[model samples]
Target: MRLLQVVESAATGVGRHVMDLSGGLLERGDEVVLAYADWRMDRMFAEGLARLEPKGLKAIKLPFSREIGPEDLRSIRALRDLIRTHGPFDAVHGHSSKGGAVARVAARTVPRRLYTPHAYITMAPTIGVRKFRLYRALERYLARLGTGTVCVSHHEKAHAVGTLGIPAPTVHVVHNGVAGPARGDRESIRAELGVQEGDVAFGFVGRLWTQKNPLLAVDAFARLRAVHPEARLLMVGTGDLEDAIRARGVPGVELLGERNGPQTMHAFDAFVLPSDYEGFPYVTLEAMATGVPVISTETGAIGEAVRDGVDGFLVPPGDATALSGAMARLMADPALRARMGASARERAGSFTIDGMVEKIRTLYAG
Candidate 1:
């Protein structure tokens, strides 16, 4: 099938998702075109995309700010022109809100237009209620446009129908999948990060933006160290909240910004993601694939992936005390962590990129 994938932010999970998904399709001999705009690490991610496509990647000037505006209209116009010029795409898959808004509107001639919000705008707690209502209204408007939607997890699917007022038939749940690369040199990575041999490292990987709620994790780690001083927190990736994180000055927390996903996973004992909200995080899957038990909040599709008390523990979002307690349990019990780690790896095996591609292919066929 000839496919075009559109995304707004091309740096974090959505970028990784598009890159991996597009490459998988291309490898299967499907013609794939990826269009993106306003990514944090454009040069770095662009290089990765070029290597994946080699043929070329299309560019769309879009940003992840708000509902329809002059810039959004311009993006919609530009993408419409792109679709017209490119002509006759079999499927156009849009990732995240901005891409969904643009591609669905521009897909006048496309056979199948699919949207995955990654997480719907209403999922964001930081936004004002007025804005949330407006965005939901826009979503209701777009819902009538008749493009099928893919929610990243079952939890998110529920939100689409119940909260955002999207028709149930319009949404499908596709849990984010990840297959991590070979383990990195643990000794070397640990040495670089200043993690000692016996340290129970709680790691986090993703943007340090407000949505991620890094402070909760940091506060938890600080409390964790009082009980288990050998505990450490390894943070991978940086974002808008870097200065704020540094200002907090939490001890035993090493801010290792933006290392390789799979390789860096090797240096962690257990993974922690204390995000305020998530659609479904690839970082959690990546950590699980690396055989690291995850301690994440009970939000998004996390409960679907993490079997609480078996593979990992799920605390309430933004609850540092609960997060710290979970870490404390994992940190003090090596045997328990090992058992959970094994289970985590086993759970992650089903979420491979190959599996994701096959399922999406079936969706396209349907």
Candidate 2:
């Protein structure tokens, strides 16, 4: 089948999702064209798309703004023109809000119009009621234009049907998947990050943004060090919170900005993500695939992946005490970490990129 994938903000999890999904489709003998937002494109995504281009993936750029603005109409027109020039794609799948909005409107004539809201804006814990209502209304309206809404987690599907009032039948949950991490030199990576032997290195791999709650990770790590002083936090991403995080002057915290998240997983004994909310983070899956257990907040569909005490630990959002306690549990017990890490690796097998792509293919066929 021929497919057009549209996405705004080709960075982080969304970028990884587009890159993986499009590449997977191409490998399966499908013609795929990606319309991405160049305005918000990141180097990682640009390079990934370039790599995929040689493998029969076609990528185009559209003027998609991060916010709802006057440029949406122009974006919509651009997608419409692409559809006309490309001629009759079997399905048009949009990722995230801005891309979904424009793609749904522009692909009204297409037989299958699908959307994936990695995480709805209304899911933010601190969202204002007025803004929430507006987005909810918009989402409810736009959802009807598409044949189906693909949610990365059940929590997001609940929000769509329960809060946003989208129909139950139209919303489907397809957990994000990964192809495991490429092998990296564990000793070399740890030595480079200054994580000495006998130190339990906890890694955080996401944008230093409010949603990621990087500060929470720092606070939890600090609390863990009071009892387990040998604990180290290797942060591997940069964003708005970089300066704020650095300002705290926390000891044993290495701010290794913007590295290959999966490759860097080799250096970590455990992966930490204290996100305020998430649909189903790709990093979490990648971490699990690397045989490292996760310590994450009980938000979004994390509970679906990290089986609490089984594969990893889950604490309530913003709870430093609980987060620290979980980290301490993993730090103090090498046997426990090994056991959980093995379970994490075994569980990671359930979320293969092939499984996700096949589900999506079935959705498009339906």
Candidate 3:
């Protein structure tokens, strides 16, 4: 089957999804073309494309911004032309809002025009009521253009069908999957993060944006520090909240900006993500794949991944006190940490890239 995968902000999790899906399709002898925005491309994603290009992957840079703008008109036309040049794909899959909108409108000729809202904007708690209503309305209309909306999680699917008022039959759920952790020297990774063998290192990896709630992670880490002064927090990735996070001058917190997330997972004893909202982030699954327990907010389909009190603890979003308490629990009990980490790895086995890709491939055929 011939296919086209389109993405605008292909820098983080969404990029990983497209890369894994497209690469899997290619491996199965399917002709795949990836349409991406070079302006928003990161080194990691560019490198991903490089690996696949040699494997018969065709990539076209059709620049598009993250937000809605006048440039979108040009993006839609470019997408239409892409479909023409790569004539008659079996499917055209779009990732995220912008890419989803453009692909749905432009790929009207395609038999399967699928859109995956990695996370709908309306699902954000921080979004004001007016913005929420506006996005909901726009999404409801745009969703109809696609043959189906593939949500990355059940929670996201609920928002699409229930909140956005999209037809239930047209909205589908397909959980994101990981290829397990990258093998690396654990000792070397820990040493790079300044984490000693005795130190309990809590790691956070994601853009330091409002949705990720990096400040909440720092606040929780600070509280844990009062009890365990020797504990360290290793934060990877940079974003809008970088300055704000650094401004607090939180001690024992190493801001190691923008590193390979899976490779860096070896440095962590426990992973922490206090995101206020999510659509099942890959970093969380990568941490589990590395056999590290997680302490994340009960948002998105996180509960579906991390079994609270079994594999890890899930506290309410934005609760520093609860977050800190969970971190403290893991720090004090080495036996518990080991037990939970083992459970995490065992649970993570169910969500594999092979399984996810196979399901999506079936979706394309359906």
Candidate 4:
């Protein structure tokens, strides 16, 4: 099968998903091509690509922009030309908003196409009501053109059908997957981070965006400090809100920005994400895979991944008190955290890269 994955920015979760899915497809004897817009501003893209390219995958750079303008039309035309040159791909899977628009438009001249909105633009709190409605209308228009829409979470599928008025039948939920950690020397990582053997290390991993609500996590940690003074917070990944998160002045918070591979999973005792919204964050899955008890907001499909009081705890979105309480519970009880962490690892095993790849292959074949 000839598959083309179109994505705007090769930066975060969506970029990583494109690389992982494409690489998995190739490993399964499918020919895959990943075409993404250049991310000149994001150093992480260059760094991530350095690791991804060596995995026997082909990546194409294309011009793409978030704003719809004259240059964007030119980009669409250029994308059309790329599709024409690499004609009749078995499937064209699109990721992100700009990529979805370009791919769906280009697919009109092609055969089969699928779009996976990593997180719909309309769902972003930063988008105004008028613009959000307009984006939803546009997405509805695009949904009519594609073969099918793949949502990362059930909550996302619900929004696609309920909020955006997309037909329920057209949407499919395939949660993000991650490879389990390689049984890293956690004590060694803790030692390097100057954390003692008995100190509980709380971690959060993701971009420092408003939607991630890193500041809320800081506030939650601040509350947790009262109960468990020795608890430390380790944050992974960088974003525009880095300074703001740092400015929160929360004690024992270590910001280890932009780590990839094994280092990403190591140096954590538990994982917490207080995202305001999401389309099934990969960080939560990755954390669970690393045997870390997760405490996250009930954003998008995260609730499906975590069984509250079983694998992890789920607080309401933007509820600092609830988040802080959950963290405190885990921090104060080592046995409970360990049991929940083990269950989280077991839950994550069901969402392996091979399982996700096979599901996509089946979808493509269907």
Candidate 5:
């Protein structure tokens, strides 16, 4: 089977998803092609494309942008042309807003088209209410034209059907998956980060953006420091808000921007995600697989990933006080953290990349 995966900017979650899916498909004897918009500002997509090439997956660059304009129309035409030439594909899976829109429209000329909004455009915190309503309307319209829609979490599926008014029958909730860590030397990773044996490390893995609520994390860490000064917060990934996050000057915070590969997971003793919203964050799953206890806001599909007080702790969204208390509680008790971490590792085994691939293959074959 031949699958064409379309996404805007090969960066962050959506980009990582495309690469993983492509690699998995190749391993299963299916042909996979990844098409992404040019990411000039950040070479993240380029780096991902380079990595994917070795696995026999081809990456195509298109002149597409997130913001809808004349260029987008031209890109849509280009997509249609590409489909005409290379498709009759078993499936065309689109990720993100712009890519979903383009792929759905282009696939009208073809047959099988599937769209997975990593996170819906209408649900974005940055978009205004009026614009969000418009995008929601557009998504509803597109749903009728597409073959199927995949939601990363049940919460996301609820929002799509309940809030966005998309039909329930067409949507499937396929949870995101992560590769388990290769059992890195924990003490070595900690020592390299300059953390002592007894020191507690709190880590967050995401862009330092408003949607991610990195400022809330800083504030929570500040509160946590009052009780446990030895607790360190290691923030991974860089974004526009990096300077502002640094400006807050919370004690015992280390902002190590964008460490790629397994080392990013190894650096953290425990993982915390204080995001305002998410579509099924891959980092949370990665943290869990790495045996790191996670404290996250009950946003998007996070609740599905974590059973509060079982695998990890979940607090209300945007609640800095609750976040701090959770972090502090985990930090103070090593036994509690260890137990949560063990449970997390066990739970993470269910959401493997192979499962995700097999599900997609079934969806396409059906």
Candidate 6:
């Protein structure tokens, strides 16, 4: 099959998703062309890009800004031309809102044109009502141009159908998956984080934004510090609330800016995410893959991924007390953590990159 994957705002996990999906497709002997927006690409990504050249992966830069601007017109035209040049693509899959819109409109005649809104803007409570209404209306308006809207989680699919008013028949849920991580050097990773072997280290990864609620993580960790003075919390990733979180001077809290997810997982005894919302958190999944027990809010399809108390614990979103308790529960019981971590690794097997791509491949054929 000849496939074209369109990704807008491929700066974060969405970019990684495209890379994983495209790489999987290429390995399966599919001819794949990726046209992605330029947002954030680091040194590691540069090396990945170069490696992809020899693997028969075709990538094109078709930058799309976050806003609805004049550049969108050019992007649409470029997409249409690219489709014409790479004629008769078996499928054209668009990722995220902007990419979904442009791909559907530009290549409306494609036999199988699928769109995946990683997270719909309307799903965000922080987005004002008026803006949410406008985005919802836009999504509904664009549904006619695409063959299907792919959702990464059941929660996202429900929102698309119930809240966004997209036709139920038009939405397909394909949970995102990751390649299994190679075990990292535990001694070296812990040394880097200044977390000694005997001390329990709770870790959080993702931006310091309101949506992520890093402040909640800070407060929760602070609560645990009173009881478990040796408990260390490693907060990875920086964002808007970085300064505010730092100002609190939360005891035993260490702010380690963004690091490679798989590599740093070895430093954590347990993982915590008090995110207010999530489409489907790749961080939690990555943590689970590393055999780390998780304490996360029941957001998105997290409950589907994490078996509360079995693999780890799930608290209500924004409940610092509950989050802290869960963290402390893991810290207090090493045997429990060990049991949960092993269960987490077993549970994570079902969400592998091979499974996700195979599910998607079946969809393409159908």
Query: Against the unseen true structure, what C-alpha lDDT does each candidate score?
Result: 0.81, 0.90, 0.89, 0.82, 0.84, 0.86
lDDT of 4: 0.82
TM-score of every candidate relative to the true structure: 0.91, 0.96, 0.95, 0.92, 0.94, 0.96
Question: Over the stretch 270-296, how does candidate 1's per-residue lDDT look in tens digits?
Answer: 999998887778778888888889999
Candidate ranking under lDDT, highest first, comes to 2, 3, 6, 5, 4, 1
Best candidate per lDDT, number?
A: 2
Estimate, for each residue in 3-112, the C-alpha lDDT of model 4 and write its tens digit.
Answer: 88888867767777887788788878887777788853255566656765777556778888778777778777877887788756888888888888888887786567
- RMSD of candidates 1 onward, in order: 2.4, 1.5, 1.7, 2.2, 1.9, 1.5
For residues 1-366, write the lDDT of model 6, one tens digit per residue.
999999876657777778878889889999999887667565544565677869999988886777898999999999999999887798899888889899988987678889889888888878998898889889999998888888998899999999988899879888888677656998899987788768999888888899889899889999899998889988888889989988999788888897776778888899988999887878888999999998999988898799999999999999999998898889899999999999998989878899889988877776
Order the numbered candidates by TM-score, best leading: 6, 2, 3, 5, 4, 1
Ten contiguous residues minimizing lDDT sum, candidate 4: 39-48
Per-residue C-alpha lDDT of model 3 across residues 1-366, encoded as one tens digit per residue: 989999998887888889999889888999999999988887779989889999999999996977788889999999999888787889999889999999998899999999998988777777899889888888878877888989888888887877789999988878889888889889998887778769989999888899899999999999889889879999998999999999988888889997787888888889999998878888889999999999999988999899999989999998999999999999899999999999999999989999999999988998
What's the number of clashes in each of the models? Answer: 1, 0, 1, 0, 1, 0
- Give the Å shift of residue 99 in candidate 5: 1.0
Worst 10 residues of 3 by lDDT: 189-198
Model 6 misses residue 122 by how many Å? 0.7
Evaluate residue 254 in candidate 1 and report its C-alpha lDDT on the 0 to 100 scale: 81
Residue 144 CA error for candidate 4 (Å)?
1.7
